[model samples]
Target: MAEKRTGARKSSSDGDDGASSRKAPSKKAPSRKTPAKRAAPKAEAPRRATATQVAARAAQQLLELTGKEAEGVTGLGRADDGWTVEVEVVEVRRIPNTTDVLALYEVTTDDHGDLMGYRRLRRYTRGTPGGE
Candidate 1:
């Protein structure tokens, strides 16, 4: 038999007033975020050019000589003169990868031919722009 607490009947045999004495829990709203407590932002890095930029410059020079596009260039360094850019070039007629490409030079002078660091980059079609 169910136990009766004063007037109400309960499942427990002890006549304790559990349902009458306890109150229901209330729901709370989320707290607002403060600007002072926010996380710090990250900084960005500077960009750099790839090795391909050098080869393109060399190929562009070769095209001016042959009247057609050159495919690639190789030797890049300082010589007896100013900034020396020796480029190997193949006209568009022969095999694209032919070893017969003429090595045309694209040299920049410092008023007196001297050494500036240069890169003999990848094989490219001629008319490549002056790189950054």
Candidate 2:
């Protein structure tokens, strides 16, 4: 009769167990070349200012220059490099509210709403008509 094995048995698919002190050569698949990825386009910036922004900028610049608060924005226009704005500023306060003096200033700013320069066009009392 044949004798039975008592320990682990070896199989045909089993790899080297280091008992034989031998190694098997490794195999690798061929590498594939891929195309490079493209970068996303950059966003563009605005070249002009909005009506609200223009008005606010004009009033702010006027107050800074004259040290008096701005009454309001009277006019706004777009120029080659920036904007043309007309701002009304309180120049003098009188005992009679109706006699208070006001000044109209023309302001210029860059495309980014930065003040470039300004000049006072005329002055008038609060009760005056058409600033004349």
On TM-score, the candidate that comes out on top is 2
State model 2's lDDT.
0.79
lDDT of 1 by residue, 99-130 (tens): 33333445442223322333334443444533
> All models: lDDT?
0.44, 0.79
Tell me which residue pairs clash in candidate 1: 73-88, 81-113, 81-114, 82-113, 82-114, 89-101
lDDT assessment of candidate 1: 0.44
**How far off is residue 55 in model 1, in Å?**
5.1
Q: By how many angstroms RMSD does model 1 differ from the true structure? A: 12.0
Task: Residues 1-132, candidate 2: write the lDDT tens digits.
Answer: 123232233332243565455555658766564444424445568667787898897788778777988988888888998888999888998988789999889999888778999999998989688824
As a whole number from 0 to 100, the lDDT of residue 52 in candidate 2 is 81
TM-score of each prediction: 0.29, 0.65
**Per-residue error at 83 for model 1, in Å?**
1.7
Error of 2 at 111 (Å): 1.4
